[model samples]
Target: MSEPGSDHDAPQAGREPIFMLPPVVTALAGIMLAIHLATTLVLDNVGLYQLTLWFGFIPMRLLAPDQLPGGFWPLLWTPFSHAFLHANWEHVIFNTLWLAIFATPVARRYGALPTLVIFLVTSAAGALAFAATTLPNVQVLIGASGGVAGLTGAAMRFIFQPVMVGTDPDTGQRVLLGRHLASLREVFTNPRSRNFSLIWIVLNAAVPLVPALIGQDIQIAWQAHLGGFVIGLLLPPLFERSWQHE
Candidate 1:
């Protein structure tokens, strides 16, 4: 379609394009950025901190409720709610770009509701990972990194498969088709996807060690990233099966 008089017809025209994010992905990204903007512009330092106190997932809040704020309700929601909050414009913007890239494909395949479920599930899984690593210590974990990482892992199930490009003998037209979702064994055996996952894990593992190397601590929730990725990697097959049954 980009070329004049090209015989190529879009096979899965609905498939996510490189530059254009699906509507659901765009909307979720908008919500994340909007929340960050609202917190930054509308709330004072005290208010912002208070709101984060209520919304952000602090593992310590579970151990010593009086040391922090809120009651059972806050504990119940913060695990998932923290995914909607971000540390700064840079943080949200980074996640927004990744959402545009990775979540678009997931939204295209799974639709809005399933995509939302995946995000929420992965976000909660991330919180669990964060809590596992930092108990008793009051560390605030906020941002869509976990959910985004989950989406990224989910994308790995098929995105690396080779796209079939061929000319139809009858119509003399070129066609492209989407790839099949690979099983776990296939995922580890495929070099491109295996390498991609390795790089992702290695990068996240390196985050905590940065402070040790440079003596400047960064507030990255690497644990959440890994936890979300684990769930997301294994979760897509269920979605594919669900779609088949539906």
Candidate 2:
């Protein structure tokens, strides 16, 4: 059943086969996992620390450039590099799972090349967002959450409506197509999308409080999540709109 103001009764009608993931989704997930495994299981502590220091997005390094070893040069690449690093197993697992769920549809819609671009671009945007909030703090921000969040936000623009794949000649009915991209107004106006966005924002914003309540020294990086999501919500159209109807 559809909500009173929802655009559709439910997502496109179809039963998806198990692991019906696009190649780009599968490949990216595998790469994240492999890198995490190597960093945790293969590399020694010193090596891991060095790698993290070099690759992780550190706000202090960029804000107070003279004190850091690489100076300002690292800023250009760290935004993109940090997406491939994770602070722990839980972090990588969390990101990979979300990536599988959200990125699958996007990869299917845009194919491998464009999907990769979206992930990297949103992640870079996320790094900047994180930096803006942290200012002078010497903290390492590492995870795929930014890019995965971006994919989730991007999906919100289209995943709710029925897709027209083609005619079922024998049954004389329209088939469920791949992912359908919706307009900006459609995404904001749809009840389902609105509720989804609200829930996501609330849950993410509340994450920092959880660790605080328990006295665990953990930062949730909600700033990066918001940054990626906003960009994801707005950016995909630039890559897709031209060929969307084709």
Candidate 3:
């Protein structure tokens, strides 16, 4: 039988083991950060504005295909393209850090291909939520935060699962078998994990509310975050069987 965590079936010989980041996720985050920085520096406000107009996914405005130049492709691609645009350095930096931290573990757990699929699916869901809730005339919805939020939600699912324990037949020693949802619930219900989850929820829920409380026009896109998180939370059980088979 193959080792549980082994990447391939090759014999454990003299060859150096491959040590590499998950390719699809690393590439996606790197490319997004690069584009955000490059565009911020290269384009003037007017140019940047125009770029956002063309590439950003604004659900309400996007409903009218005739308003945009490229039409259907823009709508399809916008789900990904919006992830490359940002309001400013602070926005990109925060989102990039979050993506790097949360997504790496998920990519490692699920492998690069499944990670990418989850990201795209959750991102599209986030965008659709944003479009559905807001006014139709809103010009552009930009940033990778939605996708990152999805990754966060997915991470929560991956982390919060049950574990199996058994006893050795001969030695009569306890052994941890594997993790599953029941074990996760036990962990989460404990004070530490429950506190952490509460803190996370409070902070994210406050993100949009704080801006509004300050009487600022800046929108935090909380709806997208919530949408992505819910989708990710629900997706794990559906995908779990296949993931275990892999």
Candidate 4:
């Protein structure tokens, strides 16, 4: 009953359109921003430090044998809690802006459930990477930047390897290849996407370096950023490929 090429068009038509700044992500961003502001203003310095100790991911300190509490709830909750805490106003504002920007796009593409999963997983990965590399007693690390970085990484995958419907020209039949890669030819030929991607890498990579050059003792947690970005870039292919087969 249907035309040969109709199947190809069906997927495009059936796609749930993405709305800008999905409610869940917006709410999350607002809540996180509010918490950071409240913590900075209402809470005393000692209270803030205690909050960070409980919520922040301190790598080896939390994961070490002696430090592990005799409880499961702390382990399960730390990942989410770490995201809510921040070192300072500047730290929270920077991370919150990027989280809103990158996360909105990812939430729109993957829907609320998957987007939340990605955020938690990638944030964990970022923290894990930090913990593995840094000394246990150095300093407390807090913020959503790691998770936000993961969303950016994930977005790269969705944007680059799009799901498409193509027609078999000979038979005029439509086929869906839920996973597609941009051509190598396009990498050199397409300046816009290439430049944009390059710029993102440069800016994020530079974030840590700037403070170092200024002779500041600020630890940038470059490890988390790199970890999140790698996870973002790599996970999409594996996730989508598995989905396609299923």
Question: By summed lDDT, which 10 consecutive residues of candidate 1 come out lowest?
Answer: 4-13
- Better structure of 3 and 4 per lDDT: 3
lDDT of 3 by residue, 108-199 (tens): 66777777777778888878878777865564678777777777777776465556688979999998754563234654675654665567
What is candidate 1's lDDT per residue for 114-174, written digit by digit as tens? 8888888999999999999988677899999999889988998988877657686899899
**Global CA lDDT of candidate 4, please?**
0.70
Find the candidate with the highest TM-score and give its number. Answer: 1
Q: How accurate is candidate 3 locally (lDDT)?
A: 0.72
Candidate topping lDDT: 1
The runs of at least 3 residues in candidate 3 whose Cα sits more than 4 Å from the true structure, single-residue gaps closed, are 1-21, 71-73, 137-139, 162-178, 182-198
Candidate 4 stretches greater than 4 Å from native: 1-19, 62-75, 160-212, 237-246
CA lDDT for candidate 1:
0.86
Q: What are the RMSDs of all candidates, in order?
A: 5.7, 9.5, 6.1, 7.5
lDDT agreement of model 2 with the native = 0.83
In order of appearance, the predictions have TM-scores of 0.85, 0.82, 0.75, 0.70
In model 3, the worst 10-residue window by lDDT is 178-187
Can you write out model 2's per-residue Cα lDDT over 139-171, one digit (the tens) per residue?
888998898889888888778855758877799
- Clashing residue pairs for model 4: none
lDDT for every model?
A: 0.86, 0.83, 0.72, 0.70
